[model samples]
Target chain A: MNVVVLNEVRKGFYLDSVALMRLSREVAGSPGVIEAALMMGTPSNAAIMRNAGLLEEGTAVKGNDLVIAVKAESESAAREALDNAIKSLDKPKTQGEAQAAWRPHSIAAAVTARPEINLALISVPGEFAAAEARKALNRGLHVLMFSDNVSLEDELSLKQQARAAGLLMMGPDCGTAVIGGAPLAFANKLTRGRIGIIGASGTGTQEISCLISEAGAGISHAIGVGGRDLKKDIGGITTLMAIDAFDADPETDHVVLISKPPHPDVAKSVLERIGRSRKSYTVCFIGASEVQLPANARFSPTLKGAAELALGHKQIGADFDANAVASRLPRSGRGGIEGLFAGGTLCAEAQVILAAAGRKVASNAAIPGVPKLGVEPSAGRDRLIDLGDDEYTRGRPHPMIDPSVRDDALRAALKNRDLSVILLDLVLGYGAHADPAEHLAKIAADRGQDAPVLVASVVGTEQDPQGRSAQIRKLEQAGFIVAPSNAQACELAVAIVQNAGR
Target chain B: MTDQDRPQYQQLLARKVEVVNVGLEGFVKDLRDCDIGVVHVDWKPSAGGDPQMAALLAKLGV
Candidate 1:
């Protein structure tokens, strides 16, 4: 392959991470281009390119410099792709760009320019998220923090100040929120009905909303409280506030709260608030079972169950006949399952299911009774891994939107001859990978039938931008068995393992 | 909520939601395409995309 690496091209143009990510994709899609990455020359970025064998001798790059790298079928193709890469850097503007109002260089300038503006949506690097979020909260603007990797201490302080100011601080890692029917950050294009969702998990919210829509109901709003809101430290501040908002809004009829298993005290406080709401609501805390529900609160252990309960129907979890998969197993030590998931909640759900089936399943993050996967154990284990966790996405886009890293990791994991099942979750919605199923399906097609049975769930509605049935059909064509929901998919995988032992 | 203890954000729910997009212009475009009017908050940190940029934005806010 012909490789082209350009150092220090754009001096101070200041392209944010999203712009850089799109630029990389555009260049990679160009004719004859095998691979390309256009980004600021940070150490992590440099390390990424170096791993791909792009960095060269005497190539001195710094964070402020624009580093362009490309590999192509020929030197000429590399040159042409490099030209397109540089052109992408000078991104053009639309006709109305000149007529647009000036951007205020500071939050004060912004608030002064538009007094009606009440929310500041911050998407910067993880380390910088707190400072920007704090500024917005201090200025009386509710903050929607899209950046992750923020310290929990900063989150607590920010939420504390926001509470003091009577403002909402949505997340340091919030995924989806639709306030007044405005979808933001990885949310589905949902309808404006009377049901509002307060969720900590991104895909969990999408699954619930999509199901609600399918059941002939719509959504009023879906507020993301960030993943850690129900933890003991943050104390479910956003969860209670969102419940209060839904409780007060006359437009809202029913409410659904979606989250992973939370700390007991935090869950109790949140439950008490929900118990007090005049209107009844549904709580779907995945992996958090054996909880007593209040008279006004409905409890669901799965996302699909929550949606079904919210619609006044009981959709029971069905049993899957994965015995055929078990019979094909090699009956050797390599018969473990490797679940590489993009959604942490989905990963946690699978981990819980596998553990309940009397198996050891490790994870990179804390998974209730499951032990934390040590540095090396996390590499290869009978584990359900969250590839979108901070460990895998420090300087990269989330695996939900960018499948490059996850694709590579999964391909490598599939090489394990002992792996009996390769489990995955394909989430289709706004800001998610346009066609996530296509990549994994290709990988599944490459692996032999005896290698690993690829089982997956498509977390979306038929109305999703990426057609849900169409995406599932692609996976099915590529020799994959697709399930209706993530929870069901986990059950199928567990049965595959148990049947193998039989 | 009690008038004395009602949250400050409580009033915002009743009003029309207007957004100020910071750092990423594409989001502003996305919102506008959705027919949701958005205002531009021109914020460029001193170090652009680095950790130090956060402190710079805060200083600018003050």
Candidate 2:
């Protein structure tokens, strides 16, 4: 086979990262194609292409150019893939074509066309997100930024501007939020209730909100304060604003705050602000050590616990029979547990639960007490890996958006005879993959009974586009012990490992 | 906090949610399916992704 490389530059063309990634995936899967990438010609993206050997040495391109690079078995294949990519790019989007004639090209034009536009959902590249968000704030709009890789300094300045203007800047990397009853990017369609949530972690918020909704409780509004807002430099500016907003809204009777352990000073100030609220608050700083709580606030260590508290109910998993679930598993060997998760917060929650059970679980996104996974294998140590970490997703799409990204790692874990149980999460919602469980189920089916006991959970509601019950049925039919929630999945995995004499 | 002391964003809760979606057109379907009013902005990197030129355009209010 004669290997050939080819490139095409669409001058001043632009596409969002997600679209580019999806298109790249299609091109790479074409006949005889080894690799393909569709990226903006930004400096970082150029470096990525260079490192992937898709770009020739000394190839110069402007940041606004769309770079289509492909490597294939033959020149014809490479040329075919390049042509396919361009055709896909030029194809008209069918979703909003009816309104295409009236569609605005800029924030200013959008506001001019619809002057009542109150929110801006910004998902541009990180280098440009701050500018777009700034433009939105200047127009008196609340911003929910779904973009990541933004500089901390840019985040600080943007948040400060939003705060000064009495507006909200939800994220530089904010993923999930529901305002009034409208579910924003990567959010769930939750029932309307009096419980308001402010979350720094996207998946953490989703887990808690879904749990609350599943428990027959609903949400008034779920505000996302981007992951870094509670750090020292940003100082929880959006968090404080969210608290004040919830306190003032008569519709919101209770508030839930979810995040990983925040900066100590930031946490202290947030707690103090929560103390002043008339409404009760449930704060779940996942994996954070105990801190003093105000009279109106209760502290929870897990997302499930926060949801249970907000709902005034006993543990949502109180009826979960871990032993019964474990007993049904076809355990073969005495081995450590392997957790491969797409949700970062779900992965951290599992690490916390495992660590609390006197187990040392190594993870890529480790909590306070747990240690990071080392390059060398450690004997008898359980491993929980967050596949969405930058280490695994620098050039690839997030596992949640493209579940195939976790296929190789999942397949490896399935074949590992030393693993007692392979734990996983299938997150479903608007922005996630269409049918993540079906994808995983196919992989597990390929390995047959030779694989370890597969324990999993679906983090979504029945109302989600990918029905929760259907996803669970797929996993269970594929021989997976499907837990109701992520926390319970961890518990079930632990029980299986312990039953196997770990 | 009293009703008057509420942060400016509290008022947003009572108003209808009309969104200006920047960047991805893929998100438009989700919003439309939810029956929320949305307008998509065909966004691209400004000034051909040249930071100096983009900054100058911003200053000029273009």
Q: Which candidate number maximizes TM-score?
A: 2
TM-scores, all models, native as reference: 0.84, 0.96
Location of the lowest summed lDDT over 10 successive residues in candidate 2 chain A: A96-105
Pairs of residues clashing in candidate 1: A166-B8, A166-B9, A193-A219, A334-A418
What are the lDDT scores of the predictions, listed in order? 0.76, 0.86
| lDDT by residue (tens digit), candidate 1, A313-389 | 84633344455544654543355888888888788778777777776788886566677877444444477789888
Fnat per model, in the order shown: 0.54, 0.68
Off by over 4 Å in 2: A92-101, A375-379, B1-7, B51-62
TM accuracy, model 1? 0.84
Instruction: For candidate 2, write residues A2-91 as lDDT tens digits.
Output: 778899989989887788988999999999999899999876788888888899666788778899999999999999999999999999
**Alpha carbon lDDT of residue A436, candidate 2?**
90
Error of 1 at A3 (Å): 11
The DockQ values of the predictions, listed in order, are: 0.50, 0.65
lDDT top scorer? 2
Off by over 4 Å in 1: A1-6, A25-37, A41-84, A91-113, A289-293, A316-334, A375-381, A500-502, B1-8, B11-15, B24-26, B40-43, B47-60
Candidate 2 interface RMSD, angstroms, 1 decimal: 1.7
